[model samples]
Target: EEEKEGLDKEEEAAKSGAADGSGEDGGGGKQEVLDKAKGLNWKTGNPKELKATAAALIEFCKEHNLDIPDDAKQARMNVGRLVLSMKGSSALEIVEEAIKKYGIVAAKAAKAEQREAAAEAMCGHPGNAQLLLAFQELAQLYFKEGNRNAG
Candidate 1:
């Protein structure tokens, strides 16, 4: 009988402790979770919002006939990281600038890759020295013209 009473009292104490939050502050855990979520929202700013902004920016690029990258979401995420790293700048401005600039960067990288592939293809040919020399001469001529224009 004593053992049964002790067990019942222990159970009641445990229930009461849990009901009273076990001496912990009420809603502390919930508030921490909310703060974490808010920090993440501040940093990444919701992928859906990013999508909306990116869609309009992409449409503008298309209207202007600009080439957009295949991995645009990744680009936006990367630019989001860059924007977060910046100090004293508006996030909207940074994101807008990224939308404007990252596509052109992707286009330039594509052009560079094409040029590298063409160079490799040319180098694979058996008698490409003459072609290379011609390209070198053309590059020198281009530099000369550029320098003249700059002056």
Candidate 2:
């Protein structure tokens, strides 16, 4: 009975996490943003107001110094691009603000690939070199995945 209770507790926690959209990628905030975006009545609201909301969210993230993960950044960028493409300059400005605030972190994460490659070049031990090469490959894969997802 104790084991069953523990399992039930674990399942409940998993369900809550999923409901909150805090999956393995740690994109709870991004999910919330997407939800809010979906909930907005774009046709009824003034376009400027929508843009202002996006801008405010960007500022909020900056003021909080939120450390967005790579996947979330990519998701946000993709959403921004979509909004910009659909809504013109105002939406683009919001996206630009988001990029300005979060772009550096995302770029640094991508550059980890280069750093791993450099480490691989510097290492002398054959086993270490092999491991570093594997790491470098993994980093490159992540960078490419992020780039693709961002677009």
TM-score of 2: 0.28
User: What is the lDDT of every predicted structure here?
Assistant: 0.43, 0.45
Please give the TM-score that candidate 1 achieves against the real structure.
0.26
* Candidate 2 CA-lDDT value: 0.45
Q: Would you list the clashing residue pairs of candidate 2?
A: none
Those runs of model 1 whose alpha carbons end farther than 4 Å from true positions after fitting are 1-76, 90-110, 117-151
- Say which candidate scores most in lDDT: 2
For 94-116, candidate 1 gives per-residue lDDT tens digits of: 43344334433333444344434
| 1-151 per-residue lDDT for model 2 (tens digits) | 4433543454453444422223344343443343333433332145565555545544544543334444656645644444555453343344333433343343334334444444555666534755755664676577668864433
**TM per candidate:** 0.26, 0.28
Q: Evaluate residue 80 in candidate 2 and report its C-alpha lDDT on the 0 to 100 scale.
A: 48
